[model samples]
Target: MKRSYGFLLTAMAFTLVTLVPVGDLPAQQATASSAALPFKWEELTAPNFIKAVELSGGTCIIPLGVIEKHGPHLPLGTDLIDVRAVVLRAAQTEYSIIFPEYYFSQIFEAKHQPGTIAYGERLIWDMLQNTCDEISRNGIKKIILVSGHGGNNSFLPFFCQAQLASRKDYAVYLFQPPNDPAFEAEVARMRKSKMEQHAGEGETSAILAVRPDLAHQEVATTQSGEDLKRLESMKGVYTGIWWYASFPNHYAGEGRYGSREIGEKELNHQAEQLVKVIREVKADKTVLELQKQFYDESAQPLKTRQ
Candidate 1:
């Protein structure tokens, strides 16, 4: 069955509203203080929302998260919390209207685990499409999607491509920032454990930086996250059960060595990357124009030049 997050999104918007200026950035930061505006959708007043649209250049961000079990030690909403933290921080600096918490994405692999909310696949698609459409109707044309869960990596791209199925007014940009080589080297030096994909060292450390009280480093060693190697002989094959086959516990790495220092580094890195994305998206006009051109040609492909 399909579920709607309309009520939840509205409630989240209210919780996020804050008193801030929502106007264009001046040539100098000194002038920005007087003209600055709140960058959250729920925070903006009806009047201020108009200013925000101008200030943001019609740009808005939806930080996608998922509710799933991380491990016995970490919170179930680990990905959602961490990803939202980064996007919120970035919005403060770059000034884009931040959407509320959105956790609708692919997580069927973790359905067996407690606290996992896996919606039907079709529902995920329609909800995202309607979300973007509604955002456009509200006047924001560029919708940036910053996903917190790795499981969404596959679904998000396909959703973006499906936009071509029909003409739309807005452009959807997925935030897939590339890791800095220097930063990766620095993390390698600071990291205590090599495996940090799931609720492992790196992920746990990031949570500690964002919400230390929720990160239970002591209980991190309660479960083993080692791969069971059940499908070693079928290495070339790709299957939906590959994740469960390897780590039925749904954990991927060691979290016992998570540290706040590493967490700070990782969190700051992601925030910085997102900050860049917001600034770039705000300045972008080519994408929408190109999209319009493509849609026009797509409508009359028979007339398109060879």
Candidate 2:
């Protein structure tokens, strides 16, 4: 049998979009589980790592984020900090090996701002590839990238697709934040205000839930953080400058409208969805089987008569 990289890409993307949460665990089984099962890849002892790998079904999540200025009130590591908390909590529920703090991601868009750590393009790509290679070497076959930074939206998908550049023993997956009818209803019920963008109500509320001490809701109004109308005409067409033109401060939306309750709801909901994905990936056999077949077929294209 032959395999193609396309099969791997599709499998990786499929692993993300379809999430199904399982309900409850037996008391004895839950009690027998190890605490290190949730996170800190380094913390898992050599012996325990075997168990962790099996528990996660060879699936691990690399919660990718970036360190950048997030307005006057929010911490510079807002994205990293928030996503880690959610990933850890999710792992607790579904049991997946959680990679440590990895803030190396695409953040060139925020380079003009202070406290932004943007790695060289080559380094970012290498870091990810090496990380995956190392993980695969360690026996994990499925990797999920749960990205929190808005800037990483394009970078992540592109990275996942590029995995097709060569044949690999492992697959990469990325989960979109969940969107359920009940969950959407919950968000509407919890939101106290609607802010525009950076450090806005939604983001602020999220930080408040995960790290209240760092959240300075009182100073949220210190900066306008509003649309400056620098390039209103650019709306019809999307350009890299659109963000900078509209939000010069790199901050938009209203922070005062954010509340811890809303943050908790968003974070918890995301965690719940993540739990479902972890479970599914653990039992997934179709992707691996299809990938093998495609790879085998690709090697003998001449024999594949149409």
Candidate 3:
């Protein structure tokens, strides 16, 4: 299934090249700040949404997150809030119609903890399918999904791949923040702790930047966020209960190292990458056409033999 879907995406990649405009770069707006973006989908008037779609070239972003616990300091909706914040900033810079808060994602690991609203597997699949259908119905040709939750690492890819179960008029693109050694170095140098995963230094710093008032820096040490090493046998081999075994509290890492400076740097880098993807998606041409061709060919596979 992965291979077939990968092939479809590959085919779309080739097709998108032909459909999208590619050439000279435009003179960027030098003075514009990300603060200029429309904060909510409903904020745009009916007339403005039309203009928004045109400006975005029918491309839209769905910043995915989940409503779950983020250690002891961060908010339950931390991932949703932060992901949407970055998407909003990116859309402001690049002009894509942003979908509002989307917190429906995989979080079965956190179900035991408070405020963890993990949907069932069937519901998760249907929710995503309906979301894509609804977006396409709304005239968005390309949908970019950027997830802020690590728990969705598997689900998001599976969701994207399933788009090819049958052909559709639109496309789905999922991305993680691009790798940048310089950014990594910057984050490391800015960090006060060595291992900051989950509700730790990095997440804390990010929340500090976006919403500092919400950060409980002093109370971060109230709970031990370290791995209890409870599931010692599961380390060598993976299991479904690994997360529960290590951190039953659903908290990992210390938030003491969080700072606004690091948050700003990381977020800025993420927004920049999102903006770049927007530009590339806008210029892309082949995805739709190839999807059509592939759909046509799939009806008669015997004729596709070499």
Global lDDT scores for all candidate models: 0.81, 0.76, 0.75
Predicted structure 1: lDDT: 0.81
Clashing pairs in 1: 17-43, 20-38, 21-36, 21-37, 21-38, 22-36, 22-37
Model 2 lDDT vs. the true structure? 0.76
Candidate 2 has a TM-score of: 0.84
Candidate 3 has a TM-score of: 0.85
Comparing 1 with 2 on TM-score, the higher-scoring candidate is 1
Query: TM-scores of all models?
Result: 0.89, 0.84, 0.85
Q: Model 1: per-residue lDDT, tens digit, 173-192?
A: 99989868999998999888
User: What clash count goes with each model?
Assistant: 7, 13, 7
Q: Candidate 2 residues 282-306, lDDT tens each? A: 6678776777666667778677658
Residue pairs of candidate 3 with colliding backbone atoms: 15-286, 16-285, 16-286, 16-287, 19-285, 20-284, 20-285
lDDT for each residue of candidate 3 in 1-70, tens digit (9 for 90 to 100): 1112322233223311211222332322222221233435556677656655655667878888998888
Candidate 1 Cα RMSD after full superposition onto the native fold (Å): 6.0
Ranking by lDDT: 1, 2, 3
